[model samples]
Target: MKQTWFERAIFFSWYCGIRDCAYCFMSTQPDSKKAVRSKESLLAELLLCKKLGWKIGFISGGIGAFSQTKFKDLLKDMYKVSGEKFWLNIGALTADELKEYLPYTKGVVGSIETVNERIHDKICPSKPMEPYFEMFEDVSKLGLKNAMTIILGLGETIKDFAELKNIVEKYNITKVHFYGLNPQKGTVFEKSDPPSAEYQAEWIKKTREEFPKIDIQCGIWVDRVDRVAKLLKAGANSISKFPILKKFGSKEAKEIERQAKLAGREFRGTLTKLPEIDWDGEISKLDLAEELKEKIKNKLRLYLKKMQKNYF
Candidate 1:
């Protein structure tokens, strides 16, 4: 029996200090305290991931809680030893923080979780949705790619979906990660029902329809193969995790890879390839989409004019 190497990896260096959101799996609360992993522990994990040839890494932390100094130090350490590409989800960064962090990162991400500002404020009381948008614009201007996670069943309506579409178009978010709500036992949402798999699949279809060019990472919260197939069929190009490839064994890994390919997405480990979120490229896609729409409108107008003349 041989072990498999993961091409991509999603390793959380720390539980989000920003546990303000009710759906957080780690349940990081406002008063919740978490010990920062010692620099040695973090280095060891990164080294192992690098040694295993993990191509993509998602380094995440709770909003406003992880030390920027420590994160920069970790980035410096990885650069010295490995060239594996990476993205950071160190919640609600300031523009200056984004600027400082850009050179060391392939991309940076934060979760608005929902487009409804009221829901966002209620779910993440310590942070506002405004700053995330501000930081996204700032990051884009820096020519760094940005991504956002949208958690469904978090008090959002179809109207919010329209807003989410607007945000994607307005900011040119290169990638969108869809997380089906998983209510953690100790959190505010613990008593709330999880979003139906059907609900998630429907939204996945809507998202794909609205933003055909934006890369979508779907079913990070799903574990069942049947539902995964549903999500993939609904337009999810990627599943969130296949960590078992690195930790468990081959049988399940082969199945996940097979299903991913069947869904028209490659099992490229955890994160979408760093280059997939090319900020400029995505903005160009928006431009092209708009351009094509206008061209269609123009053709329709000419056809209508010809029809009117013939009828007269």
Candidate 2:
């Protein structure tokens, strides 16, 4: 299969949902200082990313503090402003709810961390697996694209891989996003370690061999940046959740470009890199109320400032 690399910009709309999944940082670090971006700010950022030529946009977070009507309105407003559809990873939506989102949704992303029932129940006690499965089935029947995210090193065994394969085939899933478990500081798995590079590569290779036509993406977080070349060779056609290496002018960004060339693939898109924009000019042009526009401008300024200081 031909190899190509692209970046996806995920915008967080809300955080700290009601579910207290053991592995989620939102659940473990409720008092953390990080603030959730307002829905208006999220819309402005999505529009800016679109203006910057990003082809894919994802709206991610828990279904926290949003009434059914409000969530639907948010989606409707996002599409109306950006004139683009976005994939959603908020949480499992019922079939009826899926229908409500279909008009503005490009696809649905499921967080099926593991197929091992025992580990899943223990790790994600509040999040039942059945809804995710049923959601995928509904997504398929609705004729929309669907993807699943799986976390490695979550006490999953080789046997779980077979189950994963069956699930993928059963749901006609076209994409699989593989993430190495990043033990959050306050989570139950805080002291645990992510899967080794070799372990990640092996499973990715097996996945490639098993599903030749499937789109496979390996996440490139801070700790796993060095594993890029091996993972590309292991058959990952795309990288997701990568840091904004370009903004720092780091050698790692150059190295990633060099490696992509060495592997004969085209690497495209910006990973969390905000482009230079006339904030005042952009905000003025938005078709939003003046108050909301000012809020978005302020939010964008703060966001850019934060990104300048942070690496991940």
Candidate 3:
């Protein structure tokens, strides 16, 4: 069967959230300083992504200190600026919150890191597992699509795979994003190792064989670039969070491209397609306040400068 190939452009609105998930890289304690990006910066990034013809825009990351009202306003601004529906992966929202965000949201992503309640409780003690499942049900009932992110190598057992199947089926999930737990230095899992490429591939293949139509996306980090072809062959139709490939012009990126072709798939948009544009000139023309416009342009200028010096 033919597969759809695309790389989603994700916008990190903030870095830290309220939850103290053990596996999270961000500071989640009460006194943790939230590195929330300005509204202008987020709008700037979204606008640039829209101009680049990337179809999907995800407001991803931890639920920072944003109130419901503030988040809703941000969503309104995002929709107004881009004139495109976006997805949210900022943790679970209540039924009412989901409804409020329904207009601007194309879907909601639930981070079901692990299906085992014991492991989940131990690893992400502050994050409730049931809420995510509840949110998925709410998202489905609201007529919006729902997806999930699952992390492997969290001491999850083979029995968890059966539970995963049940959850996907019960929630009417359309997509499942698999990530090999990239242990951070200070996190609880710091001394632990990530799942092997083969282990991840086996589960992905099982998912594909069971649910032939579901979209399976594998998150490819810098260390696992070589696993691209293996994952593609296993059943992942798309790759996620792999910006280094396009941004850095590395030989590994070239090799991944070769592997994708070998598996008879094409990476559409952000993965392999970055158009050259006049950043300052184009951002200046956007319908935004002068101060905001300058902010966006300056941010882009710095990013471009870094990219040019180090990668391009």
Candidate 4:
């Protein structure tokens, strides 16, 4: 099979300080021992990603360790190597930290999973919802792109989704990651049942109606072609965890693109754009090297061609 370019990059966080979130997929917790990775190791991984032609997508972890000197040093080292290719997914950052990082960071992930304070407090006991929003506000003030994730089936309702829309509008959030809550064994929500894929399709539809201009990614939980078709029909334009890349050619990637076209949406290969925001204009504004800018422009051109081909 012919090789293809990967749309986005996803990096793992070696340390997570906020481990107690009820629905944490990684099962990180406050008392859990942190397994820190060396700065050299992370930088090497970033280099590998670049070699593979993957765009800086998003890096996730319990970034609370960044508050400590060691993790901060590791991040700085990684930044030197990563440049603006990767977006940071760790939250609880201060204004000064955000400013210091603004030049090196492409974007930040402010994951306010739910708007219900009571449920939020009950589920994520250590991580307060207020500070997260405040951080998001700070991020917005700085003109940095931001994205958030909303986990469904955590006892939220349509009203909660409405509030999320308000947050996106207020913060100028560029993208939204929607996923269903899958109970992990031994976790606080282990007994909880996940919402049916059908329910998530409805939620995606509602979110699309609310934020037509913002990109919605329903790929977190969708794995099958039928589910991909349903999500795209419901208004999701992109997916995560997809194996589409310029490396190993996956038929699934092409099929999803075909399905997206059939549903009247364009599958802009992963990470070609910022995951959190509509970065069409922002990329042009960045002070990137000319060579990098050309590469980005080419990707945008290709994306436009794909979408235009469907219409013509």
Number of the predicted model whose lDDT against the real structure is largest: 3
Please identify which of the two predictions, 3 or 4, would achieve the higher TM-score against the true structure.
3
Q: Give the lDDT of residue 55 in candidate 4.
A: 52
Model 2 lDDT tens row, 1-312: 255554565655445565477777777655534345577677666665565444453677656646667778887867766787877887888889889888888788888888888998898887888898899888888888888888998888666788888888988888888888888888878999889888888878988999998888887676667788788889888776755523432456556656666767765644434577787787788667789878778877765665565344
Query: Per-candidate TM vs. native?
Result: 0.72, 0.85, 0.88, 0.70
> What is the Cα-based TM-score of model 4?
0.70
lDDT at 49, model 1 = 44
Model 4 lDDT per residue over 165-232, tens place: 77888878887777777677878788988777688788889878877777677654324545666777
lDDT of 4: 0.62
Please give the CA lDDT of all the candidate structures: 0.61, 0.73, 0.75, 0.62
Candidate 1: Cα lDDT at 304:
31
Writing each residue's lDDT as its tens digit, candidate 3 over 136-209 gives 88888889988888898899966678898998899998988998888887777889988989999998999999
Q: Where is model 2 poorest over a 10-residue stretch in terms of lDDT?
A: 244-253
Q: How many clashes does each candidate structure show, in the order listed?
A: 3, 0, 0, 15
Model 3 stretches with alpha carbons more than 4 Å out: 1-19, 27-31, 51-57, 243-247, 270-274, 310-312
**Per-residue error (Å), model 4, residue 100:** 1.3
Candidate 1 per-residue lDDT, tens place, 1-312, comes to 111223333443445555556667655444456645444334434443453345443676555445678677667655544454467777767878876776677777767788888888888787677778888888888888888888888888766788888888888788777777777878778888867768888888898998787767764432544466677778766656554333333445445556666655545433221122232232233322455334434443443344233231
Name model 1 segments beyond 4 Å from true. Answer: 1-17, 25-32, 40-57, 80-82, 241-247, 250-254, 261-312
